[model samples]
Target: MSGNWTEQRIPDQRGRIAIVTGGNTGLGFETARMLAGHGATVVLAVRDVEKGRQAAARITGNTAVQLLDLTSLDSIRTAAADLRAAYPRIDLLINNAGVMYTPKLTTADGFELQFGTNHLGHFALTGLLLESLLPVPGSRVVTVSSTAHRINAAIHFDDLLWQRSYSRSGAYGQSKLANLMFTYELQRRLAYHGSTIAVAAHPGVSNTELARNLPGWMRMIVTGLAPLITQKAAIGALPTLRAATDPSILGGEFYGPDGWGEMRGYPKLVTSSAASHDQKIQQQLWAVSEELTGVTFPVK
Candidate 1:
């Protein structure tokens, strides 16, 4: 497809079911709104029920709210169970929620906060919900990664939890990189079945709450440059929307902004870091994720 893909190009989604994590605000909210407006029954899977409901109300079409705390495994499982019971089949699962530049901290599962919520949480959620997707044709799993993955990122296998030392950017990069690795690995695993596909996307630099934890100096710089460098959540969501709905999009493909530095513009096919395409590393990350989350994909 050309670099002009927009939400207007999104195909009709009348009976499709889509679940978007962190759909209450920012990119996720815009994504859900667009999809719901186009006829899909959208579910806002978020940490806050009231916010999700408010978000749902603002959407024009069919929408629902589901409480999902990505940092908690118990909550993930419960949400998955509830969703399974509510919808026997799903057409789209968009893993769009994430944290950025967070202070040193851990999740309820005792993992680095960024890696835990951004990668592992989505990892486990997808695994548990795979069965519902596997039986449906044209089903898709779209993971939202970031350009940050290209910034001094490594899996840190020796100390996956960053037990040794932690740099906020490094940890955030690791998680984003994991998001890409997970997409590639999942697509490879799903290839034989030919029923579902995994694709990835990045919002570029968008004005969102994800950066609330950035250091003071960095935050000020971002704020000052926001108008020229950053796009709104609607624009930032195009790549993900394209990845989720575009019929031409293939598994393992990535989409992002089409502007300079990929910081803003329309959605277009994009490339990721060479390190992110390392098959060996991808497999290793997959194994480690399965081990960490104790949730295995049904494909393999």
Candidate 2:
């Protein structure tokens, strides 16, 4: 066995608690299910409460769905506050909610749809829930990003909201790249604070709801070729689960598929693109995120 996910087994997560945003369907739901099955109390945070209930009902084990609309900062804050008051500790936070290609849409806060939901929302959620995370000694945050990041010129500070120009593909790429930058920067911050949390993970070319914002033809084409061209959502969740639960994982290192070209397979330590490691860009993004979201991480 390769000692990656193939040889790996789900550890004892009996006492763990997790929040998985957009977890009512697709990769998020699968990841939530896997974690719950391994004995973690999983919270499936979704935009639709009724639909979330329906989705959680399909899973064989225990799961709870809570209303969480990432585009709204108010919703994110409220959810985090409520969860913090309820759960004793949050063992894992899977910032998995995101939007992919859309014609041109803006969030409630007037940010680009892809960039807003994918990067900014998760960024804010992590910041808001920082208190809950620190209480859990072995807590970890596993953020999901895509290979689309390779082409991304991250954080066009001049046109942060894509007001001057916008392309669905470009916006999606930039958002995914932001995820990587946030992940790395978060690990650095955790180390600086002497905290016991680790953060990492990537899912390359998985069949998921991320493309719900794409054109009809694009969605259909991708759906048609999903089984052949991409890995299933179950397999895609492995890397994220490993990062969240595995004891051997170290902070700042990313995990992705081990198959050819990273399209599909079990989880393994994978390298991120050079641009994902740009410290200056990470710092700039972190600062900008705090300003835009109005929620600075209260870390010393």
lDDT of each: 0.95, 0.84
Q: Residue-wise lDDT of candidate 2 within 33-93, one digit each (tens)? A: 8888878888998999998999888876668888899999989888888888878578889
Candidate 1 structure, TM-score to reference: 0.99
Error of 1 at 85 (Å): 0.7
lDDT of 1 by residue, 1-300 (tens): 444888889999999999999999999999999999899999999999999998899999999999999999999999999999999999999999999999999999999999999999999999999999999999999999999998776788998988899989999999999999999999999999866999999999999999899999999999999999999999999999999998888999999999999999999999999999999999999999999999998887
Worst 10 residues of 2 by lDDT: 1-10
The residue pairs that clash in candidate 1, if any, are none
What residue pairs are clashing in model 2?
Answer: none
How do all models score by TM-score? 0.99, 0.94
